[model samples]
Target: MEIPNRGKNIMKTLCLAIVLGGLALSSALQAQPSEDTVSVPVSARQLRIDLPDAYSKMWPEDYRDLVANYSLSNGQTLSIISRGTNMYALVDQGPPHKIVSTSRNNYVALDRQLKMEIVLGGDQGASGSVTMVVPSRSLSDGRFVPEQVVLLAFR
Candidate 1:
């Protein structure tokens, strides 16, 4: 009789433990982001950026009509089109932009968008990261203010 009661108590305890564990897992799953889209505020649309795969894959496949035109610090213009792993850029209808110089983590790109004299810095261990900056004329100072909108990370 005592052995039977002991077995019944063990089963009850095991059942309660399983229920509690399931509840914990349910809460954790609810906290994770959904597979389709990330949670972003409506007001942050300008700050919204598509994933790398979107730029590398979807842009080439579907959104190839979207052209990025950048007014360089110089007098020329830079036109960029997203293809695959490599981004193609044409400088004032000139030849394809090539890597002029490279450092351990930084590169000095001699293109119209990335002016030859400008030095771009990045976070530690960052490579091939491109950030889109939206420039607006300041009403107070009458100067161009650059606000970073989207950042795309590439290996």
Candidate 2:
């Protein structure tokens, strides 16, 4: 009789452990990023850049952390947040514009009312990475037509 009771107790304990384990797994799965969380589709792709004649060495080196490369699919106003590396003149347009550090993490508006919030994989890797920001709105916009991020490394 005692042996049978012991076997029953062991089975009950095993069942409880299994049930608790499954509950924990379910909670973890729900905590993960939802499908709505947006992320850039490309990090390995390069960007096309057109620098004006006024590129200064101080410009690229000083603002290395915030500097980025960008391309325009349509001929429209490209608004970039004022950063140290933002120094660049328009191809036929004019000179580079560098603004205060206040704009460091702000929006850089590009064509089609599309805006960019700078993307550097990590703070440490930003200097070397050819990071750029594109407005989430333009992700599905019809104006820009490029198979992939265009590679335009003028540096």
Candidate 3:
């Protein structure tokens, strides 16, 4: 029977630990974002948030069943469509705009309807109001769901 040497066993264990440590370090490094994108520091993990609101290659002609009970029409101007107290946003041809910011959850698209946690960096317009809006986000099922879109303007 070959007796195990305490010194040899200790060295072997240390060598194995060093190898595992190197592998773990390399894995962590690989998980980090590429050099190009900006990184947002979030607890538990890092994330990359890219802007330039995702384009809708195919905006369903009837993406949503316009409220039969309520319809916005009669050739109204964009101003008529968008005008809020806190955050003002409307669908436009150019890149979408936002008057609200995002938080851990619940993306508020309008600021005029409720108190905002963060203010916008740009001008809030002449209404003496603060605007903050986020681009519309859609789910895998192709349904539009903004972080927060207050449809009711005080009835």
Candidate 4:
């Protein structure tokens, strides 16, 4: 009958439409970048430094161990702690990165595994404010060259 044929055609068309829609959705998802591949904006919460308790435990009497505290733009905190000749950048309660180099008011810390360097610099004597520079590349041809740099100021 004509009615039966019409119903069959409508069902087939619906099935094809569903299949095509699914394929389109799958392709769109595949085209999107993964979380790891996506780069975080500079305004995001980049610097998270946490103060360590061991430093305090080591020298319970010396309250001067906490060198300075900085407030990031994203409402996060960064702390610089010193223990004798060694200095550390305590980030988000994460493992401390030793302050490798320093020049005047600038302090440089390197995370070799991440291939990134964090530089903190300020004009005043650890009082006014600090500028944090995160560079994605290391030194090239004996000079520090960065492919991408993110600058965050501490207030």
Top candidate by TM-score: 4
- In candidate 4, what are the lDDT values of residues 67-139, reduced to their tens digit? 6666644344567677675666653343566654333344455542111123334454333333333333333
- Candidate closest to the true structure, highest lDDT: 4
Query: What residue runs in model 4 are displaced by over 4 Å at the alpha carbon?
Result: 1-66, 112-149
User: 117, model 4: CA deviation in Å?
Assistant: 13
lDDT per model, in order?
0.38, 0.34, 0.30, 0.43
Off by over 4 Å in 3: 1-4, 34-155
Q: After superposition, how far is residue 114 of candidate 1 from its true place, in Å?
A: 6.9
- Candidate 3 has its poorest 10 consecutive residues by lDDT at 67-76
What's the C-alpha lDDT at position 68 in model 3? 14
TM-score of each: 0.23, 0.22, 0.20, 0.36
TM-score of candidate 4 on Cα atoms, chains taken together: 0.36
| Whole-model alpha-carbon lDDT for candidate 4 | 0.43
Candidate 4 residue-wise lDDT at 112: 27
Q: How large an RMSD does model 2 have?
A: 22.9
**Candidate 1 residue-wise lDDT, 1-155, digit = tens:** 35565344333333443454465557656655876645444553243322222111233443233235544422334555554534455544545542222333222224423312222232432124433322232433564343333233333
- The TM-score of candidate 1 is 0.23
Please tell me which model should have the higher lDDT, number 1 or number 4: 4
* TM-score-based ranking: 4, 1, 2, 3
Error of 3 at 99 (Å): 60
Candidate 1: misplaced stretches above 4 Å?
Answer: 1-67, 98-155
Worst 10 residues of 2 by lDDT: 146-155
